[model samples]
Target chain A: MIELRNNELIFQFPKVHTQAVCRIDFQRTLRIPDDNQEYPLPPGLGSFPINHVDDFTDNLPATWKEHGGVFIPMYQAEALWMNFSGHYPCAIKIAAGKINAVSGTQWTKKLSNRPQDYVVVPDQPWLDGFNVSKGCVRQFVAMPLGEGYTAEEQLTGDAEHGGIQIIVYPMKHDVYVKYMEQHRVFNIGDEQCLTYAPADEMGLGAGGVMRQEIYEDDYGIDSWDQTSGLRCFVHLTNSAIYQKITGHPPLHKPPTAQEYTDSGLPWFDYYADKKALQGSASLSQLTSVAAKKIQKGEGTLDNNENVHPNTIKTIKKGRVVRDGRF
Target chain B: MTFSSYIRQSREGLKAQDRRFSVRQVAQRIGVEPAYLSKIERGDVAPPSEGKIRALAEELNEDPDVLLAMAGKVSSDLLAIIRKRPKLFAELIRDLKSMPDHAILRIARDVRDGDW
Candidate 1:
């Protein structure tokens, strides 16, 4: 189970009520197209093997599409929530043995606070390393959505109120590594895995035709006004076994300055400040007055009344106004 | 030759033929610093040597002898054709001069057929 603490909003996952598991099955093997060699794996689950001998002509497209497979458990989603929030500062410590005997048991205790939202993998380090006397393990802690909303809400909130649907994919590892390298922090280890995040549309399966006309009809609704549905995926590994066998970090790179900058950290700060101001404004009588105007087909104006003529024209044309006036 | 003599000859040659090439345009075609080309044009620096003249010819898609004449060197027949219809000839000449010449011939044929 992962423990997430974000100011007043603390949530834990794979809660006692949920039996969520994070499993990496190494027995699932696919033929390496390059040499027609079969390899037991979990490392290349989301990517094509870079060193394979065959020309990537045949395998690249399939590997690119299934870059990351989809299987959602409640705990993974909760961890993603923490990642998106940009609030919970995270630190992970994995032990070679069982989680109960780990040095960071105190941190694990906090996982009980919001148990329903998390899943704690007690022996993740050992399990990840089971293959080579050392298995790969990774730990990631991120502040997901600063506003404390779920991934679904962040994604579909726009669609709920005649807004655009923004599909978000997980981040990729190469990009994460590049960011880490840019920030000059190449050695911080396994707590660094990147997941893909899609920007606008979700993928459809075979025989599922997406209705492009529906989007065409509602195309003007501002997608930027909606919140982003971003989830971070953490790859847990066994450090001792991984280092002895492969001479590399189980994780890619820890946080770097570039990663912090590229991760929209500055934008989050601005968003947080803007939200605080908006919250303060909502508490005033002005909001009630505005609501009344909205109810009566009257449009609200901003602080600066130097409105554009085009805006005025649009407002007049909208249902909120009548007779070329608001 | 001296820088001043070279610049004077270049300017006289261009003016003698009533050519309309801008220094900026020449610099852009030849991939040289505009400021450096400007200095040479203004007689502040020498006109480029023969090798540099050939390079400029290659860049501007003109005959090497015409470029040498432009730099106040020997004149050539190609220079006369270029001077007649600078824009059209420049386009035609660039197409003729590019490596793997058949591609340009095909495009020219396409243009003639109004398929471009």
Candidate 2:
């Protein structure tokens, strides 16, 4: 369950027997001491302002409405970490667009104010790309709801798979409730409480299509009143999310950085801050307030079959297949 | 070359291309301290994580995997594959080590052609 209060988005999995099972604070920074030292995660910058895409239906594509999410923004290089202060352990997966970022336990299921896990952003931007120093990740950055970038366009693909998506893989609800009941934390049927089925039975079948999308506004001035363009979001992809999304065969251990470096290949960083990012303009002049018309092409599907099979009529008179088809 | 020397050479190559990319600027872009980055270049500290290595590679326009390999690290893709089928990979590697280039090529061709 997600609760937005006081500029902090709290992700609570009360019934899940997962680490960070209590309340996982999103955008809320907390100071916690761990085994080695203290990681005083800073508070998220400003309030979480969301512009619902439904309100701007006329200006967006038809698919925009189906993808129910609000536009959220993040500044370049800013870091946000999830802090857990709950009793149960829950695993959460954070993704930017569809790309897996980093997923792991936010903290151990210790019934204390200790942090089980945390992540710093854009440093490991996407699964395929890392150390992106410049702009938001390719997966997360979307053009305006109506504007989609072409598949071939690398750097700034205008329209894109938008939003910051987060999904939680909680432990079985019965197991969690039984454990909690034994521990005397029996607030089961409270208001707006949720009970999750066993992980495999949760309809997240093989594909693991469980995700929450947070959209972005690509045009006009943003809440900061700066020209709205490409913005970044913090995405976390942990082991559970990794397994669900990629379907990678289970292994005994995660890979160490040293193991990664031993394999000779080219690792690329594609952050916008490291590139020549165009500075956003404030409304210094009255003319800047005028709605700008960005020239955009229609959203084209990335597919090979252009003509529908239903549309083709078999004509016996001139039965000829073109383009060297046998 | 040692990871330290590799870093030094890569850093030098970056500077050689653009003098404006100071250690501080490069380090800040990659989210590391100038002192720490300097230590890395001079071989005073051990090689950094794959993420940091990637950041450095992007800044230097150098191949990140090469740097990572020098530092004895594996890429995320390979790591996932290794995790997925450890025994199969080990057996394949063992067999391939003794196979001639032409035999390996034939196997690769068969796999590509969906005959294996």
**What does the lDDT come to for candidate 2?**
0.34
Candidate 1 residue-wise lDDT, A106-183, digit = tens: 112121211111111111111111011111111111111222121212232321111001112111233324543466
Candidate that scores best on DockQ? 2
| Each model's DockQ score | 0.01, 0.01
Which residue runs does candidate 1 get wrong by more than 4 Å? A1-113, A116-200, A203-326, B1-116
DockQ of model 1, rounded to 2 decimals: 0.01
TM-score of each: 0.17, 0.26
lDDT of 1 at A272: 10
Can you give the lDDT of residue A238 in candidate 2?
25
Residues A228-310 of candidate 2 have per-residue lDDT tens digits of 11111222222232344334432223122123223321222222222222211110110100011112333321221111111
In the range B1-109, model 1's lDDT, one tens digit per residue, is 6444554455456645554445655566666787887776576776777766776656444577755765677453556656866898778777678556665544433
Which residue segments of model 2 deviate by more than 4 Å? A1-326, B97-109, B112-116
Model 2 CA lDDT for position A37: 18
TM-score of chain A of each: 0.16, 0.32
**Model 1, residue B111: C-alpha shift (Å):** 48
